[model samples]
Target: MEEPIRILYVINALEVGGTEGQLAELISGIEKERFSPYVCCLRTIKDKSSYSLDCPIIALGVSRLMSLQTLIGMLSLVRYLNHNRIAIVQTFFIEGTILGVVAAKLAKSVSAIVVSKRDLGFMLTKRVIWQLKLIYHFADRFLANSKNVKDYLIKKEGVNRGRIDVIYNGIDIEALEKKMQEVSGADIRSREGIPEHVSIVGICANLNRKVKRVDLFLMAAAIVCKYLKDVFFVIIGEGCLKKSLLDLSEHLKIDLKTRFVGSQVNPIPFIRMFSVGVISSDSEGFSNSIMEYMGCGVPVVATDVGGNRELVEDGVTGLLVPCGDAEKMAEAIQVFLDQPAFRKKAGEEGKKVLLERFAKNKMIRDHEFYYASLTKEKRMAFKKKRGKFSA
Candidate 1:
């Protein structure tokens, strides 16, 4: 009977990274009756991995930072927010949050601004950090993908602790189960020229040496190869460090056993192929791959960093090795490879954890509730100001 509350979801781009993928999933999951969602990408759609949502998408075609074109794009965003009378503006990533919050303030569109901290901000440049420090106070609320991220924002970036809310990433367990049933790991292995007898250890993350420590994963893989025969490794993502990582694999003499399956649109089949799932990141905000591994009944071996300890109970769900120790990582991976019963036990326990904590429906409900509550608070504040003016 009444008009739905309009919300704009803004991000740096509609690319296939974890943050972008989560944005797509969250927007797609929102109930249409309660909210009219719109998407605004700071850059043009460079890849085909974007979501085809029912709502309109406005791509500003921003390619460079701090350029004339970026300024034009920000102005365009401000105008759009004012014209559409968007009730809420939620942003992901550093670029989008900085720009989105600035635009929201400039437009004075009566919108509740929410920003998400999806990573540890280890990869953020100095310029972006400066901007964040300046504009973070303009945001009404902050959403962090993990408690680790929230603490980092508060302790490192000097953001108010009370303003940040920790929300773990969620997985669509039903959809994931359907995909796993539809695509067998053997089918994928056969197509990729991998032998069925080999034990596959795979990681699905953007290849970055500094952040993801993918080189460390490769090092561990090489170590595992010496003690265990008939084993293979797979890295399922693309990034700037691909060339160097490939070289490192060759240098380590594990090139023959490793496969770099560059950027997959649907990496679930690849993830399903793993005997062990690994997160070697130097830092992480809650790991989507860890959830995916557990969902597929695969045990994980992750470095004890970020929210990894939150998701994995060492020796229960999987093993946790110290960050940057290849020998320790190899030892943990070998434990799963050698003991089938232990792997199965750990995997089943991991699945139970996923079902109990990281379900998609619960995430969607939490987001919807947060949005509604913020908008209500904003409205009440506005009403109070109006009452004072009238009196």
Candidate 2:
């Protein structure tokens, strides 16, 4: 009998977001017999306690976005990785990706350094592109979670297309099933203060300007509510734009139709509350919220952006409108509201796709295979050279 292969997953923090959620799911679903997973966050934030993924998590308390702290953190990570006899270093996000690669390379025990590209718009700028080019060279493998990200690295940044592999993000369809089942059991209308008579349109995300484009969603919500008086827009999750969107809704005299549920630690409850889910992002990697919505059998209308088309099938699964076009977005929302049978059919199709394509167990296996492939030192060296170093 052989000891389980050790993998160290590096990310920024376990805050409540898509990245954090996926990381937890990835670890929870990994085959424990073959792979023992350890997690390390560059910044020590709170452990997201929603799911019961009891994997050991390490955090080096560091200041946010400070280079000095990041560098110190990287050094600490190397020491930790080496001490733990970690064979594979898998990093996510920019800060984690850059530091994890160098730390893995520095640790002789680490057979390969893997950098998972979780965000498509990450390092999309001309200047930071140079940095990606530099740091990417240190990696033994570039695991892209979407074709959009893989294409960006190759076409946009001139990285080797051959080196990039599209590994779709996995979701717990079973947990999603549980979410849907649990929704029916709870008296959510009374608990959340949602009016039973009002039709709920839910958007589960951070109130950010660039990515989420929640302002546009609010504008569309106003337009939709004008025609549908019994409609109510529920914006779940909070950020800087919270106050701004609240003010805008008040000024438009549709504040009554809109409610900021604030940043929810667990969005499952709120997602289950909605009759339809909406995603109005300018850009995205794979959206888990939409997946969760679909799992809950809630129809969705999302913007046509990176990896969004992958999650949603227009006229089949859920409607996808052109990004930034609030009118089309609103119209799509109306389409779902108007045709209950169409919405239900689309939601059903989404569930089928979710079960077949985005299974959490499949995701864990893909990553395990990826980790095993990295064990070959020769392959790791080739990957490191082909990916190119930024600086």
User: Highest lDDT: which candidate?
Assistant: 1
Task: Encode model 1's per-residue lDDT on 311-336: one tens digit a residue.
Answer: 99999999999999999999999999
Error of 1 at 214 (Å): 1.7
**Cα-based TM-score, every candidate:** 0.94, 0.90
lDDT of each residue in 293-350, candidate 2, tens digit only: 8877788899988888888888899988998998998898988888879978988898
Error of 1 at 4 (Å): 1.9
Lowest summed lDDT across 10 adjacent residues in model 2 is found at: 177-186
**Which stretches in model 2 have alpha-carbon errors above 4 Å?**
45-53, 64-71, 122-125, 180-187, 191-193, 376-391
